[model samples]
Target: MDERDRAIIRELQANARLTNRQLAARVDLAPSSSSVRTRALEERGIITGYHAQVDLDRVGRGVQALIAFQVRPLSRDVIRSFEAFALQQREVLSVFVIGGGDDFLVHVAVPAVADMHALLMDRFSKRKEVVGFRTSLVYDHTHRWTVEPVIED
Candidate 1:
């Protein structure tokens, strides 16, 4: 992508609600050209989706925790199954599969600490694949929404 493409992406990242005319104006492109470029970007999969950011605390899910788990067998099938299971859980926010002492790290949010404990005992600990796990409470979380592409040398 060139400078115009990058500018378009950057502006969209800041506010996906921008109208085509607004976006074109910001990127200094004609309206038709901007629309075509944006469509092409979406078709190429560079722009995947738009989302609404929600506050867990305001939504009644105030508690957050990162739970690291070590699953048995460590096969591709087992990993995939575990990931799918985590995603299906209501309390789970995100899951990460990594190569390290732990096989998976799951981010969960609940109403209270007791709820989190219950989830660990009733759900995660009961899973046959789960052998070991650790939990850390999340006090705060921050994210960088806008990103610029890195040109590889």
Candidate 2:
């Protein structure tokens, strides 16, 4: 991708609601040219799907926590099954499988602290694969919506 492509991606990341004309103007490109470039980016799988940010408090899920888990029998099937189970849960927001002391990291949101605890005890603890887990309450969290590409020299 060139400078124009990067600029388009940067602007889109900030606000995906921007109109074609507005985006073209900001990136200093003709509307048709911008459209073509955007389409090409999508075709190349660089520009994935757009997303909306929601307020957890307004949605009745104010409490948030990151739970790191260590599951027994480190196998591909076991790992995939755990990931699928986590994603299927209503309170789960995101799940990550990483190569470290922890096998999985699950981000969850609940109506209250007590609810989070209940979920951990009722759901996670019940799972036979789960050997150990730790929970860390999220007091304040900030996510950078806009991502800047790192160009190699």
Candidate 3:
């Protein structure tokens, strides 16, 4: 919650695997203090968890697409059903239930455009709840996030 805590989060955001000694040095705090603060952040749910970015090309799947799903009878059960089904598919990396105009936004990776088309028609089209969907092919996707804190003089 303090400046030091903010600094620790910044350094960890850059690389989660940094040693406590390194983090403490960069944040200008003692190792024990840094450890305690980091632990507190984790316990308080400020620091959720670490994750690795997966390479789609390395996995033999070069296509990344975002599919927007419009569901019929947009009830909770119908939404949950569509989300669950999407998540269970091999090509789907993540399924997000969204609000606005659509029921769900699904992230999928596939070997080719033809494979994606097949999945759309064979898998999702058969579902009774799916009213419509639109696919957008991703040429590139990059994420570089930050958690910057305001410092007062």
Candidate 4:
């Protein structure tokens, strides 16, 4: 992709609701050309599906935590099982099968600290593969929607 394509992606990332005319104006391209480029980008999988960013607290999930786990006998089966179980859980927002000292990083949102404790004691503690785990309460979370990866010449 060229500079114009990158610009188009940036604008869309900022606000996916922009019309073809608006996007074209921002990227200094004609409406038809912008639409074509956008469609091509989507077809090529560079532009994925759009989604609304929701506030967890507003939706009754006030408590957020990142639970890190260290699995015993870290086999592929054990990892996959845990990942699948976590994905099926209602409280789990996202899961990362990470490396380093920890095996998995699970982001969860719940109603309260008591609910989080219940989840840890009831759900995770029952898992045979889990050797140890730690929870860190999230006070604030911020992320950027518009990200342009550095391209080398």
Candidate 5:
């Protein structure tokens, strides 16, 4: 992609709610041209899709924890089952199967600490694939909503 294409992507990342006309104006391109380019980007897989960042608190899930798990790597099949188990749980926001001291680092959120603990012990600990686990409560979370592409020095 060229500079203009990058600019379009950057603007979309900042505020995806912007209109086609507004995006075109911000990028200093004609409306029709901008629309065409944007559509082409979407078709070519440059722009995959758009998503909404939900307010987890409003949705009754504010608490967040980073749960690290040690898995019993007895076989590839066991590891795969562990991965599937984590994904199937509703409280698990994200799961990463990694090659490290801890086999997985799972980002989870639930209504309460009690609930989180229950999920860990009842759901996760019961699985034979899971050997051990450690959890870190997230006191606060921050996000960088906009990131500009760095030009080479």
Candidate 6:
């Protein structure tokens, strides 16, 4: 992509709700040209879907925890089963299968500590594939919503 395309992507990443005219102004392109470029970016799969950032604390699920798991028999079937089970759970926010001491890292949010305990003992601990696990409560969370790919010189 050219400098104009990069500019358009950067502006959009900062604010996906920007109008074509506003985006064009920020990127120094004509409104019609900006619209066409945006459409082209979407068609090329460079621009994906937009999303809203929700505050987890404002929601009922204020308590967040990261549960790391070590599964037994480290096979594909066991891993897939564990992943499917975690995804079906309501409290689970995200799951990551990693290559480390822990096989999986599960992110969950709930209203209370009791809910987290129940989810651990009743759900994950009860699974035959789960050999061991550790839970760590999250005191704070922060993330960057907009990210730009580094351009090589």
Model 4 Cα shift for residue 33 (angstroms): 1.8
Candidate 6, number of clashes: 0
Candidate 1: tens digits of C-alpha lDDT, residues 12-108: 8888999999999999999999999999999999898887778889999989999999999999999999999999999999999988899999999
Count of steric clashes across candidates, in order: 0, 0, 0, 0, 0, 0
Candidate 5 local accuracy as lDDT?
A: 0.86
Question: Can you tell me which runs of candidate 6 are displaced by over 4 Å?
Answer: 142-153
TM-score of each candidate?
0.90, 0.89, 0.81, 0.87, 0.80, 0.82
For model 6, what is the error of residue 63's alpha carbon versus the real structure, in angstroms, after optimal superposition?
0.5
* lDDT against the true structure, each candidate: 0.92, 0.92, 0.89, 0.92, 0.86, 0.91
The sequence of per-residue lDDT tens digits that candidate 4 reaches over residues 31-140 is 99999999999999989888787788899998999999999889999999999999999999999999999999999999999999999999998999999999999998
Q: Between candidates 3 and 5, which one is better according to lDDT?
A: 3
TM-score of candidate 3 relative to the true fold = 0.81
| Residue 44 C-alpha lDDT in model 6 | 95
Which model is ahead, 5 or 6, in terms of TM-score? 6
Off by over 4 Å in 1: 142-153
Candidate 4: C-alpha RMSD after superposition: 2.1
Pairs that clash in candidate 2 = none
- Model 3 poorest ten-residue lDDT run: 144-153
lDDT tens digits by residue: candidate 6, 4-108: 888888888889999999999999999999999999999998888777877777888889999999999999999999999999999998999999899999999
Q: After superposition, how far is residue 4 of candidate 4 from its true place, in Å?
A: 1.5
How many clashes show up in model 4?
0
Superior candidate under TM-score, 3 versus 4: 4
Query: Whole-model lDDT, candidate 4?
Result: 0.92
Q: What lDDT does model 6 reach?
A: 0.91
* Clash pairs, model 3 backbone: none
Kindly provide the TM-score of model 4 when superposed on the true structure, using C-alpha atoms. 0.87
